[model samples]
Target: MADKAVDALSENEARDELARLSDLLARANRAYHAEDAPDISDADYDRLKRRNAEIEARFAHLKRQDSPSEQVGAAPAEGFSKVRHAVRMMSLSNAFDDEDIDDFDASIRRYLGLSDSDPLRYTGEPKIDGLSLSLRYEHGRLIQAATRGDGSEGENVTANARTIADIPDTLSGAPEVLEVRGEVYMSHADFADLNARQSARGGKTFANPRNAAAGSLRQLDANITRDRPLRFFAYSWGELTAPLAETQVQAIARLKDLGFQTNPLTSLCDGPEQMLAHYRQIEKQRATLGYDIDGVVYKVNDLGFQARLGFRSTTPRWAIAHKFPAELAWTRLESIDIQVGRTGALSPVARLTPVTVGGVVVSNATLHNEDYIAGRDSEGNEIREGKDIRVGDWVQVYRAGDVIPKVADVDLGKRPKDAKPFEFPTTCPECGSDAIREEGDAVRRCSGGMICPAQAIEKLKHLVSRAAFDIEGLGAKQVEQFYTDGWVKEPADIFDLKEKFGSGIQQLKNREGWGEKSANNLFDAIDERRSIALGRVIFALGIRHVGESASNLLARHYGTWSVFESAMLEAAPMEGPAWDDLLSIDGVGKVMAQSLVSAMNQEAERASIDRLVAHLNIQEAERPATDGSPVAGKTVVFTGTLEKMSRAEAKARAESLGAKVSGSVSKKTDIVVAGPGAGSKEKKAQELGLTVLDEDGWLELIGG
Candidate 1:
């Protein structure tokens, strides 16, 4: 597949290639954009996308509906409230080399019906390798900040954005309404310092500055974001009440004047040659820029020209991102090692002969999964030309603004004579439990559950995490020590620590690094957390696929732990009213429901939960303050197309008014807002005798 050119491919091959490309690109998007962790290099991703586009061009009729070419970024990640952008945030077209730049210029000229000699000024700015953010301001005050999700909607991160020193809380002399778009970035020095601190504290360190910036900005807690040094550079606008300027350069100047940071290297270029020159200049200074930038962006100078050029489905025709070449080097694959995660995922790591990539020394790289090592995708499609990797083989390691290097290509010709295809282990490397690869799952997982030491230790760490019990003086290090000493093996064991090790022969104060004061403090902290909120309690359990937001949703829906536990026990059979009710919660899916039920029904797990419960007081989830709103505490369902606002916007508004927004209509549904084309849900609501309202009625009732 790698040897075959797009022009030489048959229709069937092209179709298969398209499918492979779509899946790879989609996963890459989620990894990079949503998770802030990229498994593939930018150069490799670009090559796959280019190949997909070329194949689609050759076989237009074979283009899949879920083509990567038609998509923007991945959908907004869960746990955060969603924000619908007033003006869609579009991505830019890419230009790889001088020829591509020339083609881009030519295309713009052709679209404008102008000759090559005609005057067309462009603005070139360094494309910062960071997260895209949109800040909405009203009446000169910053109101909301959101990430660039799927172009249409994004995650609301207003509190986190407010903590960045580079962003102004209130803009003076700005438009009545303005939506400033920029890149949230971390400087190399700051990123290095932050990583150093994280490593010292036994916390997770990011691989690169871009990931650090994104991870920081998207933190659930703003105080954590405030601690991380983040910066922003405004380069564009989204929604505006009035025009800022007639040209792009003037608009940027106005933004800077309004107290927003703008990239200083931005310059006006008369044509493609100047743009290329600026790009080369930026490339030359990239190493010394103090910040990470992957490319240079060229945009039409005149706002009028931009308006005339408009946009493609997901990209703007008036702008292009000319990416820099990836840094790559040859390295030897010394060995393959499997590491078991808390979720029982057997992740493969490639121990490499030490080499340098992108000015960083690399001794390791991510092998992604067993399928990737075997040169195949999840669907058995060929990858890396179906060349499997083996120990003692020469591999091409690539680093593209990622902390960890990746083996992009293997030199099969340079393979060692005795090298053999690596066999992935069929059992957990840590606990000797059988590893199973479920249907549709890319990675094989250990089925040992709580019996596995790795899973048990990680779950114990999670139980005391900041979002869970958050016991002071008890962190990952303490958890690991306690687990290794056999003082704490499960959640219930944590509660018995005082009685077991507080005095006599097994005294905790006598342990290394533990003075009497510190030991007392730790015990006090554990005791203080004996009573916890229901959401935190649920999250602390570390159920598969159930996150903080889902925990909260379940807590709100069930109200009490006894009721929730009883319901889960009833739903263990996986049917009837209890199961239906569990599935009725907006975000609860079948997989999560099953996981919850199984955890509750399992003998050992249930006994451990009950034991832990006997020692603690769990508070009911707090309801949102109604603030005199009419729909407060009511359950509302919005079905079909919403005319006044997007579904995300409507849901956000309803939630803000203290109304619960459910995806399905059930007996608990208090109101149903049905728009045009509303069918099943509307009819179901009518059948259930639930109050139904049209779009206009919904708007009127909410006083929107």
Candidate 2:
């Protein structure tokens, strides 16, 4: 997993995580429900479940219909006869962050057609980390008890449940026929004693309280369950013959009066803020609560509203489970690997022995940087208890809510005899470039720029991006393939593709995916961009901090590539007037100028640029439209149907003449270029009273 938190997942990361979670959860379900053999512990399972919920919360649009969020426990373990529940014992949807809780409340109001000012009370209760059970009491007497197997049918644990003192055998002053639904759990103290007894008797010991409760309750022999410390908490009624109370809070009180054990923390909450504050309060008390609780469950207190909200396949829309953060576990660090990024930064990743933490099988964790591995931060503060991570060392991995697995601590006692301190590489692993760290920088970067194979591939990809060179038929995939085959290594190689392959001796047409026509078309496309704007050329270089705006500043300030190149070369050695001129440009910073000067001063790099310059006619950047005739140095927005030229043609024409083409109309907009069916932008421009021009008006003003 990446070291980023769930909130930081990129689109690709989110999509990949969705697929990984789907496959993992599916396998876990098959192992636990279908085979009656759990491959992961209960705490681990809960961790995975919470992680999926948080990921889904952040990326709701990416949620799959067959998601684990819609699934309860695996289909009643295929053993004892299944007891179909009268009322579906559904699972609760989760709320990972405070925003989710607010969204839930807002959704309830929107669905009920209630305004924000309207009060909607909810009952907040502990989400016990245990197995769900449904106890049916007929005519004020307990008739049967079952597990919440698949939410529809469950394994009959009536005999086993009867051994728990918390579960009442009979009920007085209760509904004639009522099915009480709650959790079967083991307290911390009791669980510890039970594990001790099991160890003394040479029996299997559980990993946690939840596992012990589940294993004890699922026993075929009631005598075996009687010996284990099992407890129950009645929270809600599944199938009631008559009304227990008008509100959820009253019902919980009634369940308690009927001699059923209920969670004492269950209270009516006013709103999302109150619920979240209570959740934090519960979390603070979790360690000393005796019984384990994974999260806090909130249900609409009003019975009528709850009925109206009802269920959605497996969970009620009226209730949600706000889960705690994931747990940490110790695992062996098998090895450490370095992954080079597009920016030529070498990132260290720890290769683990496929240990499961919190439910997800993690094979990798981020070592952050060389400092993190050496047990210190960039600021030289002690980290991981001043223990440097080494291969074959036992390390504590914490998932928390981060999508990226983090190395929380190191277990020096479990450190292997052969373990050695990792030596961080000082050279570019890919191209053997001199990797150096500047003062006050956390990471050491390769000084190779675009010469390094890794940096060249990344720059090539960026060179064809919309804001840069944007060469047709030379996308990311084609660039990577050509670079791998030695046909292309730098941005200039793109312009040389035709001459090298035009000969019949080594034709590009012979390539697997290329033909004569396609190859010719690619060459034609390359020829079309021989005369490129100076700003685009600078941006295409991918100099560290020289972005589109910075490149434009340099291009406009210098006017031509030769002037900019001469100034950068002259300023490279020291902080002189030539460097001051670069820093004087608007949007140009000292760091950006430093990077530009550094790149232009490299001997190997200058040679490569000279070769590219020989192949093309570099255009001088135009003076701002503000200082010239119309639309010069001014922000121009284009919208609607253009009859004279395509949108791309209009944007190119405007940018060529020093007019900034903006996507949206704002107060800074100098002019609005509207077409046949102009919308909000044109209207906003008109309201702002900025110069509004039609297609023909714009064409006339620009002399197009």
- Model 2 score (lDDT): 0.76
| Winning model by TM-score | 1
Superposed Cα deviation of residue 52, candidate 1 (Å): 18
lDDT of 1 by residue, 28-139 (tens): 7867786776766777677778888888778765555446777788667655878999999988767788999999999889777789889999999999989999999999
TM-score of each: 0.66, 0.49
Consecutive 10-residue window with the lowest summed lDDT within model 2: 34-43
lDDT of each: 0.85, 0.76
lDDT (0-100) at residue 129 of candidate 1?
Answer: 89
TM for candidate 2 is: 0.49
Q: Kindly report which residue stretches of model 2 are placed more than 4 angstroms away from their true locations once superposed.
A: 1-17, 30-65, 327-331, 334-391, 399-704
Cα-based lDDT at residue 670, candidate 2: 88
Q: Which stretches of candidate 1 lie above 4 Å from their native place?
A: 1-262, 266-291, 295-327, 503-506
Q: What value does the lDDT take at residue 586 in candidate 2?
A: 33
Residue 254 lDDT (model 1): 98
